[model samples]
Each structure stands twice: as C-alpha cells, then as structure tokens.
Target: KRILYIMIALCLTSFVANYSMSSGAIASEKKDGEKVKKTTAKDPICGMEVQKDKSTKVEHNGKNYYFCSERCEETFKKEPSKYERKTKKGNEISDLSKE
Candidate 1:
C-alpha cells in the first residue's frame, strides 16, 4: 500500500512537470515567428518614419538619431552635421551638396 502511494505521487509530479514545460514551449514558439512593430520615430538620415525600438540608433552630440538601415547609419557617422536638421511636418532633408 505504501509503495502504491509513492508510485502515484511520482507519476503526478512527472505529469505536472511535462505539462508546464510543454505549455512554456508553445508560448515561446508562437512569438518566434512573429514580427512585432516597434514604437515609431523619425529617421533623421532619410527624413522617413522609423521604428525606434527596431531601427538602428546612433547617439551624437547628446542627441539620438535613428536610421532606416545600416547604410544610413554609416553615412551619418561619417558626417554628423550633414543631417542635423529637424525632420518633422513639411521639413524636408536637403542634400547638403546641392545647397
């Protein structure tokens, strides 16, 4: 009778552990294939909207700059002052070379 009780307890413990682990795996797997949209900000280098959390960001002159891609980030790193204008509303990025 004592051995029967011990067997039942072990079986219940194994079942509980398996259920918890399987549920956790399913929850994580659901997000593994999903792409979440991040909070939006302006890409200073291109004057386009960017996802601040997802996009690459560079900090210069005590300010943060977001970029759409690594290329834009490299361009800004090369010349910080070139794209220092405000990028909001009707403000457009003027090619510094043209001006």
Candidate 2:
C-alpha cells in the first residue's frame, strides 16, 4: 500500500510538472504574437500612417517602405529620387512635412 501511494504521488507530480511546462510554452507564444501586432508607419509621399502589413510596401536600398495607398506606392516607385532627397534631411523633413 505504501509503494502504491508513492507511485501514485510520483505520477501526479510528473503530470503537474508537464502541465506547467506546456502552459508556460503557450503563454510565451501568446507574448510573441502580441509583439507581431500591426506595425504602422507614415507614407513618405502622402503623409499618412499605414499598417506595414495592410499597406503597400516597397523596399529600396536598405530601407523598408510603407505606403498609405497603392497610388502612393506607384508614385514612390516612379520617382524614388524625390523621396530619397527628402530622406537625406532626416527627421527635419519628416517633422516639417507632417505639418
């Protein structure tokens, strides 16, 4: 009877530990998914905040681009020089252009 109780206790302890580990993994995955929640940026051409996934994007040179609309993306692609010129001025242009 003592041996049976010990075996049962060990089994229960093992089950509890496994359950805790699986729960922790699920919680971690939830946190990671939260981090992936929609990332947004302003369209350089139109000055509109756009969700990176929902909006059209163009990657030129080393930068990730976001667009308010397909129209803005097309305009940006057609005349990247125009946008590149403004970007060189950094946040100064971004701040001024926003207003």
Candidate 3:
C-alpha cells in the first residue's frame, strides 16, 4: 500500500538523519588533522560527567581535573589532595543529590 511505502521511507530517512548526527557528535577532526571526540571526565567534586572543553579546568600534580560548576570547582580547589587521592584509588564521587 502507499501508506506502508511512505512509512518505510520515513523510517529510513529518520535512521539516516540520526546516524549522521550521532557520528558527527562522537568524533571530528581539527584543522591540523588531530581527531577530536566528545571526551568526558567525571567531576571530582560532584561526580557529574563533564565535557572537558565546556567544564572548568584545574591542574594539580601535573594532572588536569574538570568540574561541572563553579561551586564544584571551588570545592576541589580547597582540597585538591582529597579528591586527588579519591581519583587515584578509582573512587568516583557519585550522588549528585549531595550537591
């Protein structure tokens, strides 16, 4: 039937559009040919996954950390060692409700 054909065409179009969007989001290249992906880091203060480019950055002990908000960043700044220890032990701070 025509309706069935139309539905199939709609599904295919949706599939193609979604595929393009997701692939583009996951990876891209810089002008210098460096591959860039949507890299995410767990916020040491709030346990949120933050995009590195968008989040607040802090460097301590030669490592970089990201935060979801200014409050989280301030918290980490006050006691970098505490979070650094947690990170080293693979303890991710979950439970955003605490914030």
Q: Model 2 reaches what TM-score against the true structure?
A: 0.47
- lDDT per model vs. reference: 0.55, 0.53, 0.58
Candidate 3 local lDDT, 1-99, one digit each (tens): 975455445434544444444434443356467765536566766455555555678877667887666667777789887775433456754322221
List ranges where model 1 is wrong by over 4 Å: 1-38, 86-99
- For model 1, which pairs clash? none
* True-structure lDDT of candidate 1: 0.55
* Per-residue lDDT over 1-99 for candidate 1, one digit per residue giving the tens place of the 0 to 100 score: 975455445434543544444423222233556843334455555555444545577877667787656666676899997777644654754332210
RMSD of each: 22.2, 23.1, 14.6
Error of 1 at 91 (Å): 17
lDDT of 2 at 91: 52
Alpha-carbon TM-score of each model against the true structure: 0.46, 0.47, 0.51
Per-residue C-alpha lDDT of model 2 across residues 1-99, encoded as one tens digit per residue = 975455445434544544444423322243634743334555666555444445566777656677655556677799875785454756533321221
lDDT of 3 at 66: 75
- Candidate 3 Cα outliers beyond 4 Å, as residue runs: 1-38, 86-99
Off by over 4 Å in 2: 1-38, 85-99
